[model samples]
Target chain A: MYAIDIKDIKKIYKGGVEALKGISLQVKKGDFYALLGPNGAGKSTLIGIISSLVNKTSGKISVFGYDLESQLEQAKAKIGLVPQEFNFNQFEPPLQILVNQAGYYGIKRQEALIRAEKYLKQLDLWGKRDQPSRELSGGMKRRLMIARALMHEPCLLILDEPTAGVDIEVRRTMWAFLTELNKQGVTIILTTHYLEEAEMLCRNIGIIDKGCLVENTSMKSLLARLETETFIFDVDPPTHLPSSEFFSIKQVDEVTLEIELDKNQSLNKVFAELSAQGVRVNSMRNKANRLEELFIGLVEKGSKNV
Target chain B: MFNHNYFIALKSIWRKEINRFLRIWVQTLVPPVITMSLYFVIFGNLIGARIGEMNGFDYMSFIVPGLIMMSVITNSYSNVASSFFSAKFQRNVEELLVAPVPNYVIILGYIGGGVTRGLMVGFMVTCVSLFFVDLQIFNIFVLILSVICTSILFSIGGLLNAIFAKTFDDISIIPTFVLTPLTYLGGVFYSINLLPDFWQAVSHFNPVFYMINAFRYGFLGIADVSLIWSFSVIIAFIVALYTLVAVLLSKGIGIRS
Candidate 1:
């Protein structure tokens, strides 16, 4: 059975805004999956339905083979959701928040306490466990949310924009922790604006645009679809031209030249051609981040089709 | 899993609600006590000294039951109204909404919080009355029943109000416009016998009068209304309000998106 199964879901809001238009999704057990979409793509709405925080207009959802309609509590028991916004009581202490969330899953006080301390210490929140959450900094508060969501040690964890705003150091630390959790056989479904994070962490990927699933495939297959990449090269002789063997070159300025290289060609071929032409190469870099360019192209393409 | 987690979830929600009020005792606990103290001084002592007797009992002893019931009613309603609405406004209600707890369990836990506050305030006010009058009980069972049932009824009322409230002003509207007026006209300050015949008929329409008079009968062994009728009215309101709250919660009407 799939870790999460969403079949033909539809959500029409009160004012007749159809946020989700018959979307279907499936995630295999123990898979690190990424759901990629731009703003207003129904990612959070889907997560809300799975967590029972938002009611769906029409759909069938199951977690670990337990039907959400008939076995809601049991389905909820298997899933943990870290939402896009901070939703914990600000007056609650971090330790109390974790333990309280554990209680909702039927973990007894002693066991809950142990689990609370374990996650707090693991997430580096143990030192300030007694302080009210209002006093914690932004990064610490985000980490506290993670600890609370993991209190029950759910089999399926869903994170919606979990690292939306944080310093790179803190974000990297969270990525490492999430990676460790996934390694322990917990299925994770993540939605993020950072395309590189998805490229780094997820094995399977799905891209949604305007309530439709535009692409669903393995990470390697998605990345493999790029036919050509543009590279920027700086040359020592500003006005010198390199021999064009297989690349289409455009001079950006006296020192810079743009070249589109096909995936089948190696960088060595360009260097060889430049050497034969006596063009001195100074430095080279990609014109854009690979995944970001791909993501933008995909979203724009999907929108045009609509 | 729901059955297994029900009590645990209820316990967690109940503890959290209790902690919220206790953490702000200056606002939740002390105000009711001070308000009740002033009522005892102005209405029970100084005013009663001039009005001699009411319904064959000393004026001070006569009004004590209404004052206590008033405190219980107000505290019970306010506790649930403020706590639940604040949860909604802050988005912390998602904690419970996303959990495995059943809808009825969520309602029960919140009701427990409201009833606890009502009873605690009622008990404190009763203790405070010891200095103002030599109190006696006609029927302990009826007194306990009236206090508890009224608290439960109003707690359910508060929950309904919270569920429908979109802003802080919405929560205060009913209490200020409807509840306060009803409580004042409920025979707390004077017996319905003092009103003109037509006004007495109108006073009979006020539900608060039945609750206060039944409680007064329990204290003084005298009431303007039948004890059985009052008990039935309280029970009916409790059942109706609780059923409505349960249905609303299960439907995810206000808390869910």
Candidate 2:
């Protein structure tokens, strides 16, 4: 059974703001899925509905075949949500927060204590477990939320912008922890603005725009949709630049060039043209993350269509 | 979920609530005791010296039950109101909302906390009363029942207030304007018999009057209203308030988007 199966779910706020308009999607069990969207794209709202934090206006949602309406407890038991905001009691210690969360899921105090310790240690928060959560740094508080969510040992975990304000080191650590958790057969759904993180961790991706699911496909397929790839080259200064019908080249500086190559173009032709100019070929890299380029293109296209 | 799981969830919420108030004991527990002591000093001792006897007993003995009941009612109501509202304001209440615990369990757990605080403050005030008057329990069962039922009733009131409250100021409005007036005019110090017939009839309409009288009956074996009538009013309010809280929770009125 799918970890989460949403069918045409819609959410219109009290003021008639349509946060979501008929979003339907599914994530297979044990899959690491990314739900990517721009600001106010209904990603958090959709996650809120799946976790029962927000009341949906219409349609149905099920977790592991348990209907959210009929079997709310069962469905909720299967999922853990790390919301985008810091929602834990600031005065409470991390240990108390995690243990209390486990208790809410009906775990005994003894077991809750053990699980809390395990998660605290796993999230690199063991030393700070006894400290008030508010005293922790921004990144530490985010990890505490993750530990609290995992205390119940849910089969499906949903993290919404879990590392939004975190530094690179902490974000990488979280990514490793999540990857390890997913490898252990836990279904994970992540919503993030970091397209590079999504490209690295998630196999399948769903892009939401204006409360609609604009692109839902494998990451490989989505990346393949990029019509042109931009690369930045570090080359020896040249008197002239190469010109080609398939490649768009521009001199960025004395020794740097920006080149955009179409899908059907070959780097060999561009290199031969550069060689004719007697400019030494040097190291080159993509101007931007491939997923980021595709994401921008898709969001722009979707906006124009709207 | 299993029955045991529900019990566990209840225990968790109760423990969390208990720890919360206890963690700030000086704020939660100590203030009520101090406030009650001042009342005992001012109302029971200094004022009773001049007032002489009331309801066939010394004025100090007469007002003891009412004072204790006042503490119980106020503490119970405020405990839940502040805790729940703070949770809402901080957005930490989502921890419970997103959990598998049933909504009824959530309600019960918070009520449990409110009752605990109410009774704790009540017990402390009763102990303080002992220093002024040799306390006597006319009916232990009635005393316990009245206090517990009253605490439960007001605790639910607090929950409803917290749910509807948009800001911190909103939570205090009911206690300041509504609760204080009702308790003061509920015949806590002077018996309603001292009022004219019209005012006495008005006292009958104030629910706090029934609660204080029922509790006073437990201590001094005298009441302004019948025991059956008092219980009926308390139970009816409890049922109605509980139903309102349950409906609000099910609708996710103030807690959800």
Candidate 3:
């Protein structure tokens, strides 16, 4: 069974705001799936519905084969959610928050304490466990939420923008931790604004646009769809620019060259042409992250189609 | 869901709530005890001196049950209201909502906390009243029943108020405008017999009057209202309010989208 199977779910908010149109998707068991969307594109709404925080207007959802409507408790038992915003009590200490969360899942106090300690130490929050959660830094709070979610040892973990404001070093640590968790047979569904993070972590991708599932495919297959790529090359100072009809090259500065190559073009040919013009290349990299370009392209295409 | 795990969940929520109030004992426990003490000093001692006996008992002794009941009612009501609303305001209520806990378990857990605070404050106020007047328990069963029932009733009332409340001010509105007026007129300090006939009829409409009189019967064995009628009203309100709270939670009225 899939980790999450959502069938044509819809959520029309109180004031007639249709936050999600019909959206159907599934995440395979043990897969690291990325649910990408622009702001207000119903990503949080979807996560809320799956976690039973929001009520859906229509359709159905199941977690690990347990029906959300009929076997709600069973379904909830298998899933844990880390919401985008900090949704824990600010006055309580981190240890209490995590242990209490485990208690809500029917875990006894002693067992909850052990799990809380394990997660706190793993998340680098053991020393600050007794302090009020409000005293923790922004990244620490995010990590605390993740620890709280994992206290129950859920099979399916859903994180909604868990690393939105975290710094690069902390983000890397979190990524490593999550990768380790994923390797331990936990299915992870992550929604993030950082395209490179998604590219680096997710095996499958689903992009949502305006309450609709715009694209869903394997990461490799989706990346393969990019028709053209732009690369920035650091080259030795050239007296003249390279002439090529197969690709377009422009001098960003005296030594920096920007080249746009279509799918039909080869990087070797570009290098050969640059050598022929005596413009020896020092280093070359994509001008923008590949996944980011494709994401923008897909979202823009979706908007135009609408 | 009504298994060992359910019990654990209930206990956890109850423990969290108890810890929350105890952690701020100065704010939650101390203020009510102080307020009740002042009421005893001014209303029981000073005021009772000016007015001799009321309903065949000394005025100081007569108001003891009402004052203790008053503490129970207010504390029980405010504990659940403030605690539950704070959870909602902080959005941490999502913690419970997302868990496998049944909605009724959530309600029971919060009510358990409210009842604990209510009974604790009531016991303390009773201790303070002993300094002013020598108290007597006319009926142990009735006394325990009235106090526990009244606490449960008001705790459920507080949960209902919290479920509908949108802000901190909204939580206080009912206590200030409705609860205070009803308690003062609930025959807390005087018998309904002392009021005019029309006012006596109106006092019967105030639910607090039944609770105070039932508790007074428990203490002095003299109630303006019948014990059976008072217990009946309290139980009926408990059932009604409990049902309403359950419905609101299942529907996710204020806590969810």
TM-scores of the candidates in the order shown:
0.95, 0.97, 0.97
Model 1, position B25, has a per-residue lDDT of 87
lDDT by residue (tens digit), candidate 1, A204-225: 9998888888888989888898
Ranking by lDDT: 3, 2, 1
Docking class of 1: medium
In CAPRI terms, model 3 is classed as high
- Find the candidate with the highest lDDT and give its number: 3
TM-scores of chain A across the candidates, in order, are 0.94, 0.96, 0.96
lDDT values for all models: 0.89, 0.93, 0.95
Off by over 4 Å in 3: A234-243, A251-256, A275-283
**lDDT of candidate 2 over A154-196, digit per residue (tens):** 9999999999999999999999999999999999999998889
Model 2 lDDT vs. the true structure? 0.93
Candidate 2 ranges beyond 4 A from true positions: A235-242, A253-255, A278-283
Model 2 chain B scores worst on lDDT over the 10 consecutive residues at: B1-10
Per-residue lDDT tens digits of candidate 1, residues B1-257? 34656888889888888888888889998999999999999988898899999988889899999999999999899999999999999888888888888888888888899999999989999999999999999999989988888888888889999999999999999899988998989998889999999999998788888899889988989888899988888888888888988889899988988
Better of 2 and 3 by lDDT: 3
Interface RMSD list for the candidates = 1.1, 0.5, 0.5
Chain A TM value for model 2: 0.96
Worst 10 residues of 3 chain A by lDDT: A240-249
The alpha-carbon deviation from the true structure for residue B60 of candidate 1, after best TM-score superposition, in angstroms, is 2.2
